[model samples]
Target: MVSEERRVTLREVARVAGVSVSAVSYALRGAANIPAETAARVRAVADKLGYRPNARVGELMAHIRQARPLAKAEPLALVYLEGDRATAKKNGFAQIVEASARLHAAHRGYRLDAFWLSEVEGNARRLAGILTARGISGVLFAPTVGEKRIELDWPWADFAVAVAGMSELSVALPRAGHHHYEAMREVLRRMSAKGARRPAAMIEATTNERAHRGWQAAWLAYGPAGAARRLWLYRAGEKNELAAWLQRLKPDALVTDNANLIHAAQAAGWAEPNERGAVLSWHARSAFGGIDQGYDDIAAHAVDLVVTQLQRNERGLPDPPPMLLFPGRWRECSQTSAGGHAPSLREAMRCAL
Candidate 1:
């Protein structure tokens, strides 16, 4: 039996490649700032030495790098479609994402800046020039309403790009957003636990499309079995039709994405916490119970993904874009008193029993 050769170290590879240890490490990871020829030489030497990186050690180093204080010089772009600000606010969508993105960017040592895609008039080349001139090589595309697909004339091959939501774009990029499917399932579970056997969902057609039909799909798959249990294209303006539908369906609990629908239900004479139960699929400050979409976590993860691409010099559309999903947190809002005293779901359930 022959003794195995000792494991090769990064320091040894650095000495053989005639470069500093840091240079060797950067070269292995294909990091920017080093000459192409020098990086190639370092890789060649590393391969010859049969050096294999330790997975655990690499993860530890990455964690340390991320925890270090951020440098203020680097900037990232938050690109939004033209005239989306007003619509986003009205729909209660963009504010939290923007605020959380800014907070996370600062924590990670990058300044987040906003830009409008409409500014360049759909000219990708012009947008590319603007970004390059500002030394910005990373961009986060905010969620767009009404637009199914966005086309940019810029050279996507030069910069790292990530989209904040599932809204389709011309270029394939990594996405970060809510776990709508899981959220719906969670609502069903909660309603069932509260003795709601005949649960139903009312969703707007456009809202369903925005979430990629996640709300409808989850309802159809996980909701109580029946054909008429799930209602789509629910319009609040049609009071008579809505009331008739409620009378026909007679669902013990209602799940919806629109706050207006709750008022409509009440107007239709549906008793709350007694005859019928109401649950919001999306979180609203005024809602009785619903899912918090975890926008802050989504924003933080999106920034981290963009920063990883920047550090690794991975630009342009990914060959196979990755997706990251965060599950919504359940919130109990029904048991609060006017004096501001609120009870947890468990406490409320115990009291009810």
Candidate 2:
């Protein structure tokens, strides 16, 4: 048998191209400074040899591309509104976001540090110091406890920032999380397809309002004319107020932010679908039918966005888009049944989109 040609290496390609190894590395990255002819030669040789750049080397070169000698390793800061250990632990949504951030950071050799602003005095100043010390390029703000927030505009002036929950924030930044409106819209459209009319919205006062808007938008888009539309706002302050509201509307299909609301509707004897004088939650969190919103995806995307800004040296938003919305799919909410409805929510939104 004929001997096979040896696989090419970067050194071999560099030798053939008559350029230093560093030049080959930089040219492949499109880094400036190398002469056009020299870069072209290196590229051509690389193509001929079928050379593959090492992934780890590429990451290092990326770091070098935006080098700031004084800056520390670009760390990620995860800031949660819940400062107390007990509350932060209890916030399931916050934990999910943290997990996603951790996974993404670990894969990239980046470090993620959780900092609770609620515990520190002069939270903005303290957070600024932390960012400065670690050369943090971005922040992920979980939902706030009451009005507490890290007003670190001074420190994050050149950094990337994103929020995980609640769109209403003092600082303008990009955001990624559950696309509440779209999710609710998909759920409502699916219910409407099943011949359910007179849909009503029961949303928690604290649940993202964007979700409520989605239900309303989808309902108006597909709900039959003359159908009743009731919006009952859940309040923790008032006891039994929610139950009274549900009793009064008695909608055929009730869309709630959670299963808790669905259970409440059942307690009031609204245990059937629209056709049977019962109300079903617009979307189920159960495996049968629901919207997952992929909180992990949202968290990972936020980290990516921050890292990108840091790498590009882009900073300052005359006013950052106050809100960034990522549309989510209903399918991620479940793997199986999707409630076994004749037409799935995904199938219904196929036309809506």
TM-score of each: 0.71, 0.65
TM-score of 1: 0.71
Off by over 4 Å in 2: 1-70, 145-154, 208-228, 237-248, 274-288, 318-324, 331-353
| RMSD after Cα superposition, model 2 | 10.0
Query: Model 2 over residues 272-342: C-alpha lDDT tens digits?
Result: 55322212222233322445566667778777665555455555553544455555555423222346543
lDDT of 1 by residue, 1-353 (tens): 11136757789999999999999888987799889999999989977876665433433455467663222126788888655445655655577777888877754546788777667776657776888889888888877666366766667877777888667777678989888888888888888888888777777777777787776777788888793445656654554577878778777787777645766787897655632344444344543566767776787788777876765556777878889987677766563554555545554443212
Q: Could you tell me how far off, in angstroms, the CA of residue 137 lies in candidate 2 after the best superposition? A: 3.2
Show the lowest summed lDDT stretch of 10 residues, model 1. 344-353
Give the number of colliding residue pairs in candidate 2.
3
Cα error, residue 82 of model 1, in Å, equals 3.2
Local error of candidate 1 at 207, Å? 1.1
Steric clash pairs (candidate 1):
70-109, 124-153, 124-154, 125-153
> Could you say which candidate leads in TM-score?
1
Superposed on all Cα atoms, the candidates' RMSDs to the truth, in angstroms, are 12.9, 10.0
